[model samples]
Target: MSSTRKKSSRGREGSKNRRWSDRVTKQSNALDLESKIFKSTNPRRIALSLKRSAQASKRRKGTPYQSAMSMLNFYINRAGKSLSQKQKRVLERAKDELRDVFGRK
Candidate 1:
């Protein structure tokens, strides 16, 4: 229909002439107002993001030894298939270091 075609053409014209800065300024003002209102809230009532106790527990956990053990296990499991002698020796040395680092042997 001609009416439908005219309506779509009008929409295209309106969009073509609209200033980009007007939309950007409106969005910028909205975010600025939101941040100002958020900052006005009581600081003491803000929920803690990361718990101190959880972080302390994580810090006390062994990380390097666990990763080294996992690496050693992977290399050991893959040792028997298609590797050269030099590669096998290097992997064996790394496994020994992993065991010593973890105080296992």
Candidate 2:
């Protein structure tokens, strides 16, 4: 057999190795994420979100325009996350409504 034939056989093995490596990487990522979740009682993301909301609420000073803007911001931020298709559509509509209501001013 020629050296090219041997190289082709090795390439075939490399493809299989690639697939197994992909699976192992995915599984390890999942396990690491799970362990991180278990190690922390409170999720940092939610805590940060809540802290930001509180600061925003304080800054708004109970004004109508601020309230509307805050709600719009919350809706827009939420839409960026993993939402259902229907929910995404609803948020889009809500954003338009906010724009119309606030834009008129």
Please give each candidate's TM-score: 0.31, 0.31
Task: Name the lDDT value of residue 24 in candidate 2.
Answer: 36
Local lDDT at 94 for model 2 = 50
lDDT of 1 by residue, 12-46 (tens): 67786565443432333212212221122232111
Prediction 1 TM-score vs. true = 0.31
For all candidates, the clash counts are: 0, 0
- Model 1, position 35: C-alpha lDDT score: 23
Every candidate's lDDT: 0.37, 0.41
Which residues of candidate 1, in runs, are more than 4 Å off?
A: 1-63
- What is the C-alpha local distance difference test score of candidate 1? 0.37
